[model samples]
Target: MGGFELTLDTLRDLAEGAAVLGTGGGGDPYVGRLLVEQQLRAGRAVRIIGVDELPDDALVLPCALMGAPTVFHEKLPGAAGIVTALRTLEDRLGRRAAATMPIECGGFNSMIPLVLGAETGLPVVDADGMGRAFPELQMETFAVMGVPGSPMSIASDHGDAGIIDAVDNRRMEMLARAVTVQMGGSAYICDYPMDAREVRRTAVPGTLTLAARIGATLRQARDDHRDPFAALTAMLADTIYSHGVVLFRGKVADIERRTVAGFARGRVRLTAMDDPGDQMEIVFQNEHLVARRNGQPAAIVPDLICTLNSETGAPVTTEALTYGQRLTVYAISTPRIMRSPEALACFGPAGFGLDDPYVPVEQLVGGP
Candidate 1:
């Protein structure tokens, strides 16, 4: 299929779908949905193109928000920040951007590129660095596949901006995080500046479109009075994320979230509704990292650990999670590219400082 236009009607699906793929991070997409809506309302258009559609030499600028997700709920970002960040990066590179793409297939991050596209009339590529949202900048397929994340530019809503040309990808994350903290805990960033050739080689393809498809499936299931979780897993069956499983169904027993050192660090405990003694715990640093079911590893990164509303099947971001809420937690296996040694070494359990080794969710659950 070719590229499609993002109409107002479709924005809802894209936002909701991206949230599902966000894996309990990426901030809330609702703020981004409003931003995109405002843009579309003003008669601007946001077009999405597949990676194959990009010219080999096309300069693609990938953008995202960096900092604690919880801070974003209060210090909201605006279009000007991203636009400014893009221009600042282009000025540093001495070339104009041919197009914009997301650094990750996250709720707000996915939509931010669309905001840039709508503002600049540049087509947004339908791919991203990470197939799912990650907490750190270096935890990306692009980084693992040899893309330098330096020459990065960050901007705040107040118009403050800075560029960091780090020596390495990990350094880039460190320096960027420091700046994001100074920018009031959250900031928009343009990084991983690369040509379309590198993008096609390193990026996770079709993530934006895939997110829209997932959103539509969940909406249809709910409208038809079908089981949305079943529908969601069924739809994911044919995708790159070929395996998915409902790990636990319970109420939030306890939550401890805090903004520390530019990241949202926390853990949540869940008690099984039928058997209170049976419990699950998930630890996160900006994004959900590892989930332990009764003190055993149920899912670990680079696989996705997502939380959803038990009754509505809507995704719940880590910032929005509250105590006593009934939620369904599920895990989706990462694509092969993300499971390779290089990829795992970048975002595996050890990368997040966890003791559990990298284990595919499919293996842990037996199968999808």
Candidate 2:
């Protein structure tokens, strides 16, 4: 498919879909939708182009918001933060960025680049570093494929800006996390500078389009009085995320949340309203990592653990969960590229301090 122009209607759909893919991380997409909507109203037309359409020599910069999602609820990013970071990165690189891509294709990070593209007059590539949102900077296909995360630029709504040149992606994440904490716990970043060829090879293709489609499908399902959960599973089954299953349907029983080391660290307990004896637990560090049913492992990180409001079919972020809220939890498979042993080592349950081994969501769910 050719490039598509983004409109307010589609932006709403993209935001909803992206939140589903966020897996309880990446902050809320509503904030991002509002930012992009403002740009659209100001007459900026952002184009989403397929990776295949990009010229091989084009320079593409992956962009995102970093730090604790909880911070974003209190301190909204400046409208110019992403654009400033993009310009700063281009200046540091000594060349203009031909386009901007999302560092991840879930939640606010997914839409930030579109707003940046509208403001900077750059096309937004319809691809991203992660097929879904990940909690850390290094949990990306670009970093896994040997792309450097720096020289990176970060800008805060507080008018602070800084450049970081780390020896590697891990160091980049560490240094950037320090800077974000100093920036009041949230900042925008432009990193993973790559040519079109590298982007095509390293990025998860068509995730932007997938987000939009997922949003549209959910809307249609609701309008037609069909099961939104069923619609979601069918849609995901057709994509690289070939399996999606509801792990549990219940009400929140308890929560233990705290911000530690610049990340939202916590776990939530759920008990089935219909079967009170059936219980599940989910652990998270910015994103949901491991899910267990009746204390047995049901899903692990590197796979998605998505929570949705049982009634409205809307995604529920980690910070948004509360006791007594009825919810449905779903688990989806990560992309094949992200499930490799090397990639698993970087984002698996063990990476988050859990002792369980990595397992694909499909295996746990017994197929799509």
Which RMSD values do the candidates have, in order? 0.9, 1.1
The Cα error of candidate 2 at residue 19, in Å, is 0.4
For all candidates in order, the CA lDDT equals: 0.91, 0.89
Q: For each of the candidates, give the backbone clash count.
A: 0, 0
Residue 97's lDDT in candidate 2: 89
The segments of candidate 2 whose C-alpha lies over 4 angstroms from its true place after superposition are none
The sequence of per-residue lDDT tens digits that candidate 2 reaches over residues 1-368 is 58999999999999999998998988889988998999999999999999888889999999999989898899887568888888888999899988999999988898888888888889999999888888889888898888888999999886678899999988999999999898888889999999999998888888999999888988888899888889888988779878888899999999999988789989999999989899999998888888999988899988889999887678999989999999999888888888877777777776677889887777776853
User: Which window of ten consecutive residues has the lowest lDDT sum in model 2?
Assistant: 359-368
lDDT winner among the candidates? 1
What would the TM-score be for candidate 1 when compared with the true structure? Answer: 0.98
Predicted candidate 1 versus true structure: per-residue lDDT over 1-368, tens digit per residue? 48989998789999999998899998889998999999999999999998788789999999988878888789888889999999999999999999999999876788899899999999999999899899899999989999899899999989999899999999999999888888888899999999999999998888998899888998999999998889988999999988888999999999999888987899999999999999999999888999999999999988999999998789998888899999999898888889889998899888888889988888898864
Candidate 1: give the clashing pairs. Answer: none
